[model samples]
Target: MKKNNINDNDIILEDLQPSHAIHLYEMMQDDRIYTYIPENAPAAVETLKEKYKMFSKGSLRKEEVWLNYAIYLSSEKLYIGTLQATVQLDKRIISIAYILDPKKWGAGYAKKALSIMLQNSKEQFGHFDYYAYIDTRNERSINLVKSLGFKCVEYIENADYFKGSSSNEFVYAKISNK
Candidate 1:
């Protein structure tokens, strides 16, 4: 429930705004980025605009909060991707998700951004469990989260029922000792 803007020396994580749609649309144009995600790459900026607006409004349920951040590179001065956390207030649990422009892959930006986001989440929510649901075939994402200490807890079958396709996914989680 605290303010969501997060910043580090190299990256800026800001609340998703309507104006970010164009940049976000550009980021999503690459088919490689959406290979494991539920939806295909967005075909139009309008779709991104609508999505951003909904994200800005956030969740209405009192105990649930949905936060989305448009990732910006401070050095490059560009909007590159998105990172989000869906928080369960009463349970103090957080589910983290993120996507980066495929062009920016192997640059370690996702790792840095996630580290900052996780630290911020812990500071804001105190002790909480972290979770990430990754497509079973997404080796990159699976390794990324695992490198961050998330362990696979469940194998979900045909769980990604989006865009006319069903794919299996794995639930990765880490319980905070705090």
Candidate 2:
């Protein structure tokens, strides 16, 4: 589990726990979430809990770490989304990802959560270059990363086959000055 509790007043990101499985699973049931993602929602709450349990063990090795956080709204007392980041210390890179409930899209929650995650990652993982791989058809995600200063560096065609068709992706990177 994560030790840091990151927040920007309006939203807070805490360590993702098995307890969050139920609420998150409910949100994940929305098929729109899987449009660009290669994986479907957890088949069951138990499945998601088991996954979260493994996630709680933290990284097993020194060169890489998987960081996952659950986004919470204290005012509304609800779980709204999640943040996932892979810190590849050996490669000096960080891959950041996030998912928000479909009902909550366009509310700026993701931007705030991601901004906070990137800021915290700087302290935890140093100045590694940050990256995001988004499906070409995901315009909102593309615009979000661009607004955060990420520049598209590569276009990958037929990156993966999911939901019955092949997908092309844009590799966006926020290069570190260091």
Candidate 3:
């Protein structure tokens, strides 16, 4: 995968790197960040570094291309969180996901970052459908995706088993112009 570091007026999307592991671990330390996700925060920065290495090698593995970025706020000069796109090249489909520091909540940073990311993705790969799988209980995420024009296409039961229990998830999607 070609690494592209995209800069916007408010935020910069930098390719995920080993240097970001510590910041990512700190940003995701809050349990609230993982409330809706199937995976919990990494136990340590070392683990996160290993995971980042794996993600960097995603394209070589040939299963799917995982484009991961660390969200940096230019104004604050801080690493806020992360954004990822799981691209299925064979199907020409992309699934987007993101996490932001709870401290930055309600600041409209996520929306701005996503807007820039979408524009960049479209430029690099052309028009393709985007999807987001969110837990039904995550009102913020559901609303966020809805605001971006993602319609709920399915309600999946027991879609994920995390923290020792199963949880339901909703599939939200947007079909871009071909």
lDDT of 2 at 176: 99
After TM-score superposition, the amount by which residue 105's alpha carbon in candidate 1 deviates from its true location, in angstroms, is 0.9
Write one digit per residue (lDDT tens) for candidate 3, span 10-118.
Answer: 7999998877998778887889998888888899999999988877666664757888899999888899988999888778788999999999988888888888888
Displacement of residue 62 (Cα, Å) in model 3 is: 3.8
Residue range 101-134, candidate 2, lDDT tens digits = 8898898888889999999999886899999999
Query: Model 3 lDDT vs. the true structure?
Result: 0.87
RMSD to true structure for each model, in Å: 1.5, 1.4, 1.4
Task: TM-score each candidate.
Answer: 0.93, 0.95, 0.94
Query: For residues 89-157, could you state the per-residue lDDT of candidate 1 as single tens digits?
Result: 898889999999898988898888888888887887788899999999899899889989999999999
Ranked by TM-score from best down, the candidates are 2, 3, 1
In lDDT terms, which candidate is top? 2
Clashing pairs in 2: none
Q: Whole-model lDDT, candidate 1?
A: 0.87
